[model samples]
Target: MDERIRHLGFGHPWLRGGPGAGDGGETSRLPWLSSLLLAVLVLVGTGFAAEGQPDREPLDVFARLLLLAGPALLLLRYRRPVVCVLGVALSVLVYLGAGYPYGPVLITVAVAVFAAIVSGHRRAAWWAIGLLWAGHLLVVHLLYRHLPPSGDAAASWWPEVGVAAWVAAVLVGSELVGMRRERWAHDRRERAAAETRRADEERLRIARELHDVLAHSLSVIHVQAGVGLALLDSDPEQARTALTTVKAASKEALGEVRQVLDTLRTSGAAPRAPAPGLDRLPELAEQAAGAGLAVELAYDGERVPLAPGADLAAFRIVQEALTNVVRHSGSRTARVRVGYGTDRLTLRIDDTGPATGDEAGGSGNGLAGMRERAAALGGAIEAGPRPDGGFRVRASLPLTPKETP
Candidate 1:
């Protein structure tokens, strides 16, 4: 085959946009310019090669049409690969058997075979190529005397070795290309699936954050509003203080909510305020106190800096546990113990006595959110009724940081 013709056919657009080429195995359009260029090259190349093979039959009208048939058939390769390959192979075989000059006419078969394989018609492509090879064998060894170019004698068997090698090379190279394309498609699907999972996890995290922020603040506001309403007639001064607590709680809640929203608004900008951590424990306790649940804090060891993810998780776990106590427990006090070890941070929150209502467990997402937070940080959260009396929530968090997804 002419090198230029081979190059042109190999670079054709049909090869890249064939079936299963990332367009979901659908043929969207035709490669008109490439097909025309290939057809022209095949015709011109064969005409030139015929001059070098004066002993063979000269280029005639029917012979030129056979050279053009392969490229014309390839227009349907993506949609009808089997038919296209069969048609192209048949035309090439007929041209070969007719004693016409051999040149880039083989390029047509190459293009058709490649397109068929790329479109996932490997068996059809193999059959087509195999048919061409067998037909060449018959024409060269058994039927040459009865064919055109009357005085031609039988060709040597050694060239058959090169032909076999060429066939093997074509099949091997086409199979390699097809395998690579399949791998590329698999990688694309994996990346897409991973991105979807990350999106879902991010959404769940945002929902959990919103729930914690609103649950704790709203619970406090609900209690303070009740206090303000009840003490309005009895003690105006206490009622004013209760209203003040409500105002402060609502304001803080708004700030936190805005911070969360800011993260969404800004793609990668820094947060307006730092995430809450153990340093804000006193503030958390004060808010719980405002809601009529007095909190006691006990520190067991020295505090150290923590990774941002672990710090945030620790803070949220405590906040959610305290909120649970405020909503469910009959006891008015909660004891929060913080132990700072070399590699771990332990937190224990307990409330004395039984629960307030019949449904003491408090059917809410607070506990589940805490568990998720701890688990995300490679930590664990345990919550249940104490054997003695009250409810207890214990969490163990690692000091090591985790990569942000």
Candidate 2:
């Protein structure tokens, strides 16, 4: 109901309101009848004058008033359609009642009847419509006190009912067509909005993933580059090994970025090799210890073999968590838990970071990337600063495979 009112411009006729209301389309179709009918009437008046038919003697003044007023009512048909119609009916009846046989007013009278039919008020239109046409027949005959020409029932009655009924049918049909047009327009807008939302979500996910990949790899390279620079004056061979680690991590970051881009370009996601999972936690623990951070790896629940994507997601979650700890935590202590339950794979990372600022939980996209990876695999995540003055990253991926196990 609200939509309908909006479409009709608050139902104010003074607003020049209708469907397609805001634009000039409603007024685009010119009212050709006003000009055309008057021009034809001018020529008609000239022709009748040439014929030199004698004008009628003066009748009651009321009859002349009606003759003047009847067709003028037609001009206001749409704005006050019923009033215009009723006025025409009464005025024309009075004109005939006072004995004018025929007049030029029938042009506007015919138009009024037809306008009423074309609008949706068939009942009002039909009644006034009946009086106008029926009055024409009765007036012509009774004034002469004789039957109309070719006065058979079929010939006389058929044109009136058939023409009016056809006009009413057209009005109803047009309203139905307008309804379909409105429905189509609404559906088109909704579909376009949905597409726009999907595009936005995809861009955000891409941004988060890009940040995680670059941040993780760059942090590792920064460590190795520092070691190489330190060992350059001490042990040349160890420095060369540090450079190799930096090179390998850099190459890995480039490959990850390219794979994400490839998936976007063709919408054909390439298979990613299985990455670090719970089984590789020992290596992560050793790396943290080497970096002078005490990291404990623990597990509960059933040990489950994760899919390749889930494994990589779990690895990144832990990686980002520990990286954040090293960068922010004053204490060199962190704990990671990989819990493989019956229906889900969970990775929980906790660090004794200062958790001082709003960014204590890693305000960057590392946490966001973890969540996105889990969500893409039909999963969930919750990460923020712990009340115990630390940060935690917990992610869960559903065990169900994308296709089949």
Candidate 3:
């Protein structure tokens, strides 16, 4: 099979307002043109031969041999797009040697330029368009003296010049249209990739939410169960009380788990209690007190209205901070402060204890969860040792979405 046959195109099918991606059907025009040009060559050669004109008139047998190669060159117009433009233009030069009319051959050159830009090199395509028509003008002005000039004043042959000018203009205009189509294709791909990334990130956020719900509840239950098992021998009554606390905590954990999983795993709407806000700080303090941590709750400023998202985010930030204090900070007493203002809400959890060892290594996902919650609120958090003793975690969140109406 010939390699040139593979690249022949039937022009663009989406010339009208059609889908850009289309199955390009055969146009049925190529064979017709090939036959017409062939008939022109045979009839003209026979008539002139009957008139006894020189068989080697201007383009002699040698030049006709190259002209014989022109149709084979036409098959190459779409293949080596840039190279074929020069080939057709060179064929035009060879045709000029035969005194053949140059009008019809210019279209093949235009098609070559159009093919180049559509193949994705805009600059090369543009240059090909210019140089192709320029070849026509150079041939007319320098080589073919038989053609008429422009009004006896202009050096350019106005007939051939007009034909070449339109060829260049149409090639360039077609390429501009092709560029817009290519850019649209590029933008569509980028948008699809962005949407996929957003979906993946959303799935990850839900995963983090599930982890937070399960880990906090399970950690509390694990501590209570261990205490109950330790007291099973001597303090059987206390052991029973610990088992009751574990059972209640486990039931509450199940409810929290259901709410979270329902929001994620199904289309059912989440519960509306507006989530936990700054108003629930005392309740959290009381729960910490039950767990044998000395909790001191404090507040400052007015009860400013908060965006529900900000409110819930603030509450979770403080909850995770305090949970870390219980598990890692080894602090006897923890102080939690909630300050509400017109513009923003600030939360701080400071724990005071004997500073012994640092919390590091294999601790997995405790402190990182606090930072993640804080970031989700469009806020900032810091956890590190304070000056005197113990550790502190502070997070600040805005009352409303800043970039929203």
Q: All candidates' TM-scores?
A: 0.83, 0.56, 0.68
Best by lDDT: 1
Off by over 4 Å in 2: 1-168, 234-237, 269-297, 305-313, 330-333, 352-363, 368-390
Pairs of residues at least 3 apart in sequence or in different chains that clash in candidate 3: none
Clashing pairs in 1: none
Task: Pick the winner on lDDT between candidates 1 and 2.
Answer: 1
Give the best candidate by TM-score: 1
Clashes of 3: 0
In order, candidate lDDTs are: 0.85, 0.62, 0.60
Task: Please say which candidate is ahead in TM-score: 1 or 2.
Answer: 1
Ranking by lDDT: 1, 2, 3
**TM-score of candidate 1 to 2 decimals:** 0.83
By lDDT, the better pick of 2 and 3 is: 2
Model 3 poorest 10 in a row by lDDT: 14-23
Please state every model's RMSD to the true fold in angstroms: 6.6, 9.6, 8.6
In candidate 3, position 50 carries an lDDT of 32
Worst 10 residues of 1 by lDDT: 8-17
What local lDDT does model 2 show for residue 294?
A: 82
